[model samples]
Target: MRGIAIRIHREFQLMDCASALSIEGLVLEMVGAATRRRAQGLSVRPSRWIREVKDFLDEHFKEQINLSTLAKCADRHPAYLSQVFRRCYGSTIGDYVRQLRLDYASKKITHSTESIADIATAAGFYDQSHFAHAFKIHTGVTPAEFRAATRKK
Candidate 1:
């Protein structure tokens, strides 16, 4: 984990658009390893309700989502759903949704010639600026930089 952190730090320092994909991959790898380690210590599996909630989020992450609506769908209290989701996934529902959106936007940015604003809207971002902010936070580069960097590879 420490080595991953160090590598990520080095990548960030470089701020090379081409390495952005590698950085995202490294981050995912680190998160997966951490999640696995956390899960291994647990004695019980995640509940079916939690799994269902996760599935719902996976499918609807690009759409408007809220805890109350998810709570109603799951037949559970919002607080309970939030708590269980965090316990099972080590991340809040909102964080998970944002990650999904970012992942989708990154792929579109890299694979298509669409305008940034268009891709942002398609990815469920309210506007280009918001998408750029989130994209930079998640990928360590702006959409244009990511696109240019990936294309250079």
Candidate 2:
């Protein structure tokens, strides 16, 4: 991880009013150190496949994203890609993409005054209905209901 990434994460934790030196924070620090040590000062790591997949997802989240295109992007067999992705992220690619889109939508919904339809489209769901289904499935409430509740807060 970049030093800036670590710093920003620590700053965010502090801003959240959590302990800067909590057990979880300490464990994350140690894990990061161990990872750096294991790299053994190697530059240009062997992350071609995963990096390719991540880039593809980042650039193409708004379309009809599919596993076949991702497998092709990584230049790996579909099964291998699926297995490797699960090992790295503890979730299927579909679930990972959905989570990412929902996270993006949530940030927009909270931070901006965009209409729900616009937010849904911006978050990569092709249509409002699909976005509604996904939002409700993940958050246990429709987007309208979520916005309403947040207003109450």
Candidate 3:
């Protein structure tokens, strides 16, 4: 018989009860997680960890964010978090953040005397160019152009 060895990292652990099962049964048992994950359609409602994930995104949109770190907080995988967050919120987290930034920029431009650069900074954009691009995409004009047009009309 051919033999192989597997090594597991101490930091990452999985629980398995397949030791007593026959080879075929062990294989079936190992496939159960995958089968159930697909059968149930990974769309869990946003409860528990998902709510915390949403709150974190709302608070931290101005900073660099990583899916791995956010998912770690929820005790879930990034792909899984992305999937269910989208399923529950009707949009991806990225989209939600972008919308937030644009909405905030719109409100700031409409109500505050802050320069576009300052508004962009406050909205979490790296620079005015990046902010302008996103703002134009969201509002159909460059920030200055938008301000001029709004003021004229």
lDDT of each: 0.80, 0.69, 0.67
Worst 10 residues of 2 by lDDT: 1-10
Q: Which stretches of candidate 1 lie over 4 Å from their true place?
A: 1-44
Give the clashing pairs for model 3.
none
TM-score of 2: 0.64
Which 10-residue window of candidate 3 scores lowest in summed lDDT? 1-10
Query: What is the C-alpha lDDT profile of model 2 across 1-153, one tens digit per residue?
Result: 233233344344334345454436656865776576456543334366776786777677766788887788678899999877765544577877877787678667767889999999989888889999988876556888767655554
- Per-residue alpha-carbon lDDT of model 1 for 1-46, expressed as tens digits? 4446645764765565666998898999999878785766532578
How many clashing pairs per prediction, in order?
Answer: 0, 0, 0
Over 4 Å off, model 2: 1-48
Off by over 4 Å in 3: 1-45
Give the winner by lDDT.
1
Candidate 1 accuracy as lDDT: 0.80
Provide the lDDT at 96 for model 2: 73
Candidate 3: tens digits of C-alpha lDDT, residues 38-57: 56664456687788888888
Give the higher-lDDT candidate: 1 or 2: 1
Please give the TM-score that candidate 3 achieves against the real structure: 0.65
Clashing pairs in 1: none
Error of 2 at 39 (Å): 23
**lDDT of model 2 at residue 117?**
98
